[model samples]
Target: MANNPNENEQAQIIHWADMTADRIIKQKGDKGQYVLASGITPSGVVHFGNFRETITVDFVARALRARGKKVRFIFSWDDYDTFRKIPANMPKQEELKKYLFQPIVDTPDPFERDESYAAHHEKNYEAQLEKVGIEVEAIYQAKKYRKGDYKEQIKLALTKRQAIVDILNKYRAEPLEDSWMPLNIYCSKCNRDKTDHIKWDGQWEISYTCELCGHQGSENLQTTSRAKLPWRVDWPMRWVFEGVDFEPGGKDHSSDGGSYTTAQEIVKEVFGGTPPVYLQYDFVSIKGRGGKMSSSKGDLVTVNDVLNIYEPEMVRWIFASYKSNVDFAISFDLDVIKTYEDFDRQERLAYGLEEGNDKKVAMAKRVIELSQIGPMPTVCPFQPSFRHLCNVLQINDGDIKKTRVFYAKDIKNERDERRFQERSRCALHWLKNEAPDEFKFTLNRTRPALDLTKAQTDFLNNLHAFLEKEWDNLKSDKELHEKLYEVIHSVPEFEPMMGFTTLYQILISREKGPKLASFILAIGKERVLGLLRP
Candidate 1:
């Protein structure tokens, strides 16, 4: 269980500004300034799985800045990477394949006829990061670094191209056998760089064909090489070109002898600079029947899906709740409901509306710490239950503001309010799947239908009468339970315990529920009698 030193500090961990300053001091050792960099490819809608890396890098950046160190945090979008394939559930399928080799920034939006698909994906993710409080100077790879902005480095790579090939050979890895192209070959057909055959003729001649498109090209091995560098070289090359100090990547690249290791060596050898410190983050698995959310699989749960159910802050809390290496699970279940409730309870305590227990205080601190961001908009007033608000307004024919305020006051805490809001939004879901018209309220536990004997029917009638007459007198749970028990005891034909079981079965279909007395009180004696009458 390795812990992050920044988070596990014994004393009050200083602010993010202070942390950044401290890291800068240590990394530079009295040097001038340092820059932090992170990047992601806009291949698909940015899912929580993809966010693991982005959030980890953002946290590191924040930590560095907190320490009074000058830091430049840059987030690069690898939009120039070719579109891979049309994901499932995307509105258009075969139509999008035409742009497979083009940069993602040049692709058309699947949903819209006019907008480029790359812009569509980029716009959504930019908004998501804003919601999550991640601020970074964005660089689009297609625009910023394209047209050979890294021409010098590319030239260096070409000069030491043989050296890189020698290193690959040392590792027993064979270079692509084609002769007309440079060592690195990016297929114009697939838009992906994984191609075959890089054959070298004499000192300055090589060629390769796109394994995907079969398009072939030749270039001088000297300065006229048109092939892109392999990822193993490209990644470290960027670290040197951009002066990246720290960047976090997925565990795949962070493995014991993965590309990052090779890239680090190439960065030192080719670019004469050390690669950035790397933090490896784990995957996020979605709960229920769906497979693990994946951008490549096109079965991803995007940040928008979470925002639909949770506030921006709660979403941030999820990112901060666990360390980078530990995989975590998110469910649309009772557990999620409980988490929202707990967050609300803690929030109430923090705001001084309730008695704060130590646990509540700690939870409150966690929520606030994770959600720290710029000032929240005044326009986005907390709406506890979107469905409830919609329903109350729909039924009463009133403004949403009135309903929001009413529900807000009743919520007791922020987390509970959020839970109720989510549940409310799911009202239509439960109604469609679980609820029955015969009973307006769905029973948590279903009871099988039972035949009522003559004696049972008569006893039920008497019980109903007793409840109808005593309904108003039953002011509390204790009073209701006592009256019901007394009536059962006085009935010679009815055993009190059996009668109680019969009553519970007719109502809840279970032998147990909330405190029986409290349950009856909450539903009211009249409703209970109506439910029990034969």
Candidate 2:
């Protein structure tokens, strides 16, 4: 185990786990066993922001395993926390309002069928992790850990409680407002914890009445205890109790001189134990949408929402492309298409399908393989923008006509079938949202009566004659536009620009759209001359 490995040193570090394991071994010697942990309070729908912590931990855990290190990754649900105010979107707010101060584990599952509310939220997030290939042993705090699994550690802190209290009191006295209560106990009666304060009076202490519920009784903090250690002590206490080696958390806990730092001190002081190695991850910011994706705010985009537009591999690539410190953005717009294009290009370079001058190609290839996509395509040449694909699909009635025809005609290109399928789904979603009206062509029943004045009639006749004669010779869109403008300019009877506009409107309106010159040729010179005969 050594200090942080350089890029040159990175090559020597073959697997991510080996790099992490080496670091752990350096810190704790050969006896160090690596473990990963991510904890969440199931206060709302588990949004993508919450999932970031899970994925971050999973990446490290997988990397450790790749390095031939034994890794145990566990997730803890903070279900024992009292239910706060009912979230706004909750269907039955009034009914559940009564359970606000009780442990979430004791509340009935909002969905009714689930065993408990905590279980319902836990299952929802667990399902998402499974979908994203994130694996972890789940530890439910309310059930397993809180039922005296950590009783010895809890009692140790309780006996040495004065020391913990002194630290908190000292913190509170400081001008920086760094202090917090050492214990958070929910009264079995009024159920509120924050508003109530406890005062120790020798062997016996009197409990104050809750201002809201007005329920009061005499109680003992040292005896008949139903409280957990405060967050600062609880965090490090868990590390000591579980013998955890590594864990990642949001900046709130991991910030400079924050709870994590303070907890490290308490762990060594009260428990006489070493704390785990900590990686502080920053928040992922979404584009166009201000602020982080939050479950409580109900402003979150779920993992399922993202999977609709992108392949799982591409989504993972988006995460792996950046280091944890940088804040990033994800959009469901044309930008998503650009991301896919970038992923495809990188995938090609990695597999030697495309010539590239950079050694990063090997790293890209490693990511591609890790993401589990098959070998790169050999003959598939076209890579359209997501917006372009959407437009094409829209014009083809969501049929993806060009891709389907290409695949059908090229039997040898069958190796790229899966790539086409994945892209087609992305195209379908773009078409559905962005260009629904143009996805399919349909004809109208009746044509509008053309009531042109004498000058307008003559211009139409001249335009028809010009198109019929030069239709076959026309080569490009620019050429066709120039030809149409020439007719409009020479014929004083038509307002040149208006003539081109009218012709375009008529063609699209009549034929559901027509090839510029071909439709003029099809309608014929004699019919055009007669229709314009004012």
- TM-score per prediction, in order, is 0.69, 0.72
lDDT of 2 at 39: 94
Task: State which candidate has the highest TM-score.
Answer: 2
Best by lDDT: 2
**What RMSD, rounded to one decimal, does every model reach?**
7.0, 7.7
Scanning candidate 1 in windows of ten residues, the lowest lDDT window is 438-447
Q: Per-residue CA lDDT of candidate 1, range 336-423, in tens?
A: 5455655555456545456765444554454455455654322222434332333343322334344455455566555556545554
Residue-level lDDT of model 2, residues 1-534, one tens digit each, is: 235656785574243323455566677565535777889988767777776788777767766665666778889898877787676666677778878877788778877868888888889888877766777899888765346565556566666666776665554545323233355566657655653554434343435445566666555544534566666778788887778888877887776567777787788889988877776777876653456776667566667666667766666666666566666887665466567778878777766677775446656655664454343344443444454445344334467554465345433454445446666786686545533354333222233366656665566677667656765686754676677777777766567656754554443343234444433433444443344333
Candidate 1 wrong stretches, greater than 4 Å = 1-25, 28-34, 68-71, 166-227, 296-298, 341-367, 372-408, 411-534
- Indicate the TM-score of model 2: 0.72
Off by over 4 Å in 2: 1-22, 28-33, 166-181, 190-225, 289-291, 373-388, 399-422, 433-534
Q: So what's the TM-score on candidate 1?
A: 0.69
